[model samples]
Target: MLKKIRWMAVVLLTGLVMYPLPLMADHQGAGQNSTLVLEPTVVTAGRIKEKKSDITTNVTIYTREDLEASSIQDLSDLMLKEGFMVREYPNSTISVAIRGFSTDTHGNDLSSSVLILVNGRRAGTGNLAKISMDNVERVEIIRGPASVQYGASALGGVINVITRKGKGPFTASLEGTLGSWDYKKGTVSMSGAVSQFDFDVTGSKSSQGDYDTGSGSEYRNTGFDSKERFSFNGGFTFLPQNRVGISYSDYSGDHIGSPDYLSANDPDDYVNHGIKSYDVYYDGQTRDDFLFWNIRYFKGKDEYETHDGAMTPSRTYWRDTDSQGAQAQITAKWAVAQITAGWDWVDYEVSNSNTVAGKENTYENPAGFFMVKTKLLEDKLVLTGGGRYDEYEVTSDTGKVKEDDNWSFSCGAVYKITGELSVRANYAQAFKMPTADQLFMLTDYSAWGMGIWSGNENLKPESSETYEAGIDYTRGSLTGSLTYFHTDFEDRIAYKSIGGGVTQYTNVQGGTLDGVEGSLQLDIGAMFGWDWEIVPYGSFTTFLEYEDDETNEKFQYTPEWSAAYGMRVNHVEYGLNARLNFTHYGRHEITDYEGTGATTLGPDTVADFSVGKELFDMNKFGKIRLKGEINNLFDRDYALVQGYPSPGRTFYLGLNYTY
Candidate 1:
């Protein structure tokens, strides 16, 4: 491990040394300004709009243009292709890991250490596949503890999806696509502003048959019958400084085949899932622009059903989850300081039904939080601090109740070394409450000599304290960042198998995780004053240490290293755009389902390329374009998860029209 770490560090240093620094001569006669441009703005880092360069945390943003240039079908696809640490199954189940901490793809929203938000509210589902990207304007990801801004389930990080809003003149678009494995997709969207009212709406549907592996063999039951989505965002501005808006989204997947692992192929298992969410909000500011405030209320539902037709009598299991929440916040701005305070309340109810008796559980939480940001030294040094307190209650149908409370805090600072460079460090404390299933579970198996499986109401919430430091550099045609982080985790909840065939949940000593993450990008065309824009980028993560304290064993499913490299091209004169990227995952350990011990999985790499070109434009009518994509260019046979193999080489062609 030490040797590997040293080798990676040496390689990174060599690359940095070989890259040329920005040249003043390149900009002097190019008719371009030499001044640095303001970095992109983000809201998830501070719970308010702020320049990315000013934030004391690590953040990644993906704009609509970036999405359009990719061949991804959904959030899961995007994350996997972008080299984010994730485990995806053939049935569309995906789990994301950040800094060695992960979310549960099959668990409820509240159970995950990572949080997913839509427009700054809970998405109500942990499955990324259920979140459609068709109506997203952008995505903001904060890669560290965020409990001070959001409440629980933000121990690892946060992913916020910001939907599109209407602006400019009325416009509409229609798109259709065809791909391998009998895949078909169609979409329609309209957006515009009329007087004080603005709106954006979109609808899409897609279907696919089973896909083949790299060996040209069919991976039976690895496709979905159909998937449908609809989303709308609209608002009315009653005053110049105030607006009332509403948003709605719906997603459904019908007959999604769930194939067993390659070792245990079961062809008669499948699942159906659906998710719906809606929210209403009012945003306003004082006439002087010194005070800004927002209030919102949201509700959502998630349904999941699975069928096991291979059983003698066949069995079906179903779960329904309902969630509702409200949030209000106010911010006051001054010359060199800003303050924000907020309150939040939410409730979740889940019910399960199957061949056995039905069961129901409820969880409720309320919280208050505050944050302050101050600048000094001629705005070259920025400081931020925040804290939150939450009280929660849980109830089960078996007349059991559990209550708990927690507090989180964070502090950070950023210091500008130069106009184009900065350094930052942060410390944050986060926690995740015990889930209802872990606190109130009760099952009897003594008749079969399995004794009892029970939960412990005394279990405490898991907690972590993280420290991170990083540097950011942004010069003409060049951008880069590097960060190092360490986390101390404690009181992790796990099930223990005691003697007498008894199993019970309890809090156990946790572990530590340390890693380094970095990214670099440069635009060759802009640097040399060429006619076209050409950019090359690369990013990677290397784990220094990740292990459990109790057994001194490394965590499962976390690779020692992962990387992504790509290049993008654009020619505005010809209305042409292209992208080629490769994502690589290093060797990792995976749990052996067929045995009690663990097993190691080999490394794998996947490549994708996409290109689009404008065909023609008819005045008063619309513009037409054609796009093509090839995924798995090398046709590599690999599995992200132990048993679920990813599809092989695939091709797609699409036609789009806009007015």
Candidate 2:
């Protein structure tokens, strides 16, 4: 896999130096500026809008234009191509980790240390399956502790999504996709503004049949997936400085198959899942724009049912989870200093039909935070400091309760050495509060045939201290950055298999991770006065020293080395775009499924490519475009986990029309 990827890189580089491309001008449509912005704007790092170059944390932003140029089918696709450290498991489960933390899937619990948010509010589950790329305006990712701004579960980082809002004149769009494995999908959306009211609405449905592996054989239990989704956002500006808005999102999946491990096919295992979420918010600003405030309330719920076996004696398991929260925040600025303060409350509950009656687990958390940012040395130097306090409680149906509290702090600084170069450094102390399931769940089931285990109510919250530094450069149409980060964890949680097929929860001494990430973008249209563009990005992560005094083994799932590099090319005049992506993961030493010895896996690389073109445009009828994408283009036979092979050589064709 490595050799293949290297050869492809050579070919790409060789072609770039020799190929001759035309110059194309950029267009941002009506009421939009054509000026090129090399650095994207971001909000996840500070809970406020700012240039990525101005933030002390390592941040990445993906704009709507970026999304439209990529072969993104879902959030996972976007992350994979962007070089984020995302883990993809069977049944399309997707999770992300920053600086080598929050990597655990926990069998789809979606309660990892990483946090996911939509419009500054927590999105339940953080399950990629529950996230759809519809009516999305932008995505910002912060790569490190964000507990000061986002509270618990942000120990690793945060993924903040911003949805589109109505502006300008009315517009409509339609999109459809057809692909290998009988895949089919369609989407429709509309956005417009009327007087003081604005609205955006979208809906989609999709389904796919079974897929074939690169070995020309079918993957068992990897049956089919079908889904439906709807989203709406509307706001009314009742006053010149105040606005009220409401948003709703719903997603449903039917008969999603859960394939067996190691190329094994199972015809009888599948699940049905659904999620519904709603948000109501108000935003107001005082005169002179010195003080800005926002208040919001949100609710989200998820349910799923799994079926095993084929005939009448089949068994079934089902679960329901609910999450709700509210927040109020104020930001005030004066001169070179800005202060932000906020308070929030969150609640989560989980229940299962297979568990004992009235055995539901519940968790409640309330938090407050204060942050300050200042500029010194004539705006060449920036400083940020923040702290948060979180109080949490866990309760079970049996009347048992546990209460705990923790405080987190962060400090960062950025220094500009020149007009085009800058350096940044940050330090943070973050903690992950124990989940209700971790503290109160008593249900036990066999894990990979290893043993039966139940949650431990006495477990303590996990904590970490992280340090990061980086350099950034932006000049004309060229932009590049490199960052290195390290993290040390304490009291990390783990589920251990004891004797006699019994497992128990325990605290590991902890672990340490260190890594580097880098990205580069060049606009050929401006560099050489051509109308083309190219962006090449890459990242590398590894554990410098893991394990503790009690164990010498490396942390599970911590690859010795992982790297991803990709390049995107575009010709604006011709409306042509193409992208090539490659990723490699080093070998991992993992405990065997049968509770025996360890096994070495991975050290694999995968590549993908996509191309798109505009077919035609009618003045009043809108513009139409065609796209083709191929995943696993090399047909490499590999697995993210032992016994689970990735799909191979799949193709997709799509059409999109916009007015």
Candidate 3:
């Protein structure tokens, strides 16, 4: 099956690449100054609004248009479709890998190497599948270390989810969908602006039953009972240059199946999870436009409960985490330079129940950071430098305390060679503090004939330094970029088996990673001066090397290559839109749990297609659209993880009403 899919993938990719070659020459100068081209702006790169072409780091942006054209339901699905390495289990657990570093899919925010943010603040959880896309306006991704801009847990990269804001006049939307495996979903949203006030609100509910594999076999306990989500963003403008706003978001999943592996399937095991967040913020600028300032305070909570009916007594385990933080920043602008300074504070408290020894821990972090940017030579050359200092404190209910401090720094430069091309280089340092479980926990499971686990109080923080360079070009109906990066990591923390049935956490020599990322897109209709729109796009990542110094092994789930390519068509006059996308993943090594060697998986391709058509318009009432989608078009049998197989071909149909 794998071999067959590989052959089909090669043929499909070759045809896509060759189809656009013949028309390239004829459309070179057709739309040189077309208004269809617009540069994207990002805030995750420098903690301030800046055009992608002017930033010194690699970044990726996905606008609302991109989201509306796909069948994505959450962040994990979007990342996988965009050529990033992702690990998805049959039980709906998901995590992302950037470069060679990855997030902890089973851990909290503080334990992850990659940071997830909502409107520029901590999201409180590492599991990407829990984050809904109902109210997301745009997504910004920084592909390299951002420790100098953000604080800890940013050793790999950063992902910021920007929510929608109300504007113009009052409007509302309603949508419903049904798919394979008894899947069903419904959503409602509204937005409006009145005088100086604006607001947006959304709510959704979804559920599904067991799903089948590509081979037509049912995968038991691979579905969830139900999931619910809500989001809101509103604000009032005053004094012309200042605004205050409030934001709230909530997510809950009940009776989510947790079948670990096909070989060890447990039909009666499940989990319940919930997350809630609230924020209040204010932003303003002086009338002279010389100084700009913003401040925000946020609070959130995450809760999980697992029920194990496979056990004799039907055991239950639970964990509850609470988090709160505050952020304040100010930027001073000058003729040739701009300086930004900020302070951040955050605290996390975690408690566990139904354990042999109930436990509780708390973590606190305070930091100050600053950045300076200067433009030279008629604004053709841009230089930026920044640094951050952080202090961390950890405490346990057992009367154990630990304290640590660290500093991070970064520098970068961008030079525009022409009106449509630019070159950039950057160097940055990042770090991650030890988690509470790794620093203060000790469990003696020897009485149950299991290995004992102990934490190390003297473990140093894990750190890494990265160097990267890239080139970006944008002109007319074409846009593209290519970047190469290298990272050296140190003081990696890993558990090692000592004598007897015992394991202990310790710092080990780290590893090195090197990779290249590239993307390209072209609007065929705009380039040919046509009345309709047709675009072809592709993005890919290739790993040159990924090695561990201690074990001389490549990281698991780090694919050697991955790519996403497709085409889109839109005709406004006809009220029609369509899209076709293909996602391919290359083979990589994985740990062999049953043996001492490594195993391999992947080199699979999956295709998805969606289309929508406007049915009618009722003038002042609203418009109605019919939409449909098919995922895993070919039904190729594949598994992202060794024991968990992905779903087979699935179909969905929906209707959207706007007013």
Per-candidate clashes, comma-separated: 0, 8, 0
- Give residue 219's lDDT in candidate 1 (0 to 100): 87
| Clashing residue pairs in candidate 1 (N, C-alpha, C atoms within 3 angstroms) | none
Query: TM-score ranking from best to worst?
Result: 1, 3, 2
Q: How many backbone clashes are present in model 3?
A: 0
Candidate 1, after superposition: displacement of residue 401 in Å? Answer: 0.9
Among the numbered candidates, top TM-score falls to 1
Clashing pairs in 3: none
Worst window of 10 by summed lDDT in candidate 1: 25-34
- Among all windows of 10 consecutive residues in model 2, the one with the lowest summed lDDT is 21-30
Off by more than 4 A, model 1: 1-20, 24-29, 32-38, 310-315, 354-359, 444-451, 594-598
List runs of model 2 lying over 4 Å from the truth. Answer: 1-39, 103-110, 311-315, 443-455, 497-502, 546-549, 594-598
Better of 2 and 3 by TM-score: 3
Candidate 3 deviant stretches above 4 angstroms: 1-36, 310-315, 354-359, 447-450, 594-598
Model 2 per-residue lDDT at 58? 87
> What are the per-residue Cα lDDT tens digits for candidate 3 across 153-267?
8888998999998989999999999999999999999999999999999999999998888998778898899999999999999978798999999999988888777667778
For residue 541, give model 2's deviation from the true position in Å: 3.5
Which lDDT values do the candidates have, in the order given? Answer: 0.87, 0.77, 0.86
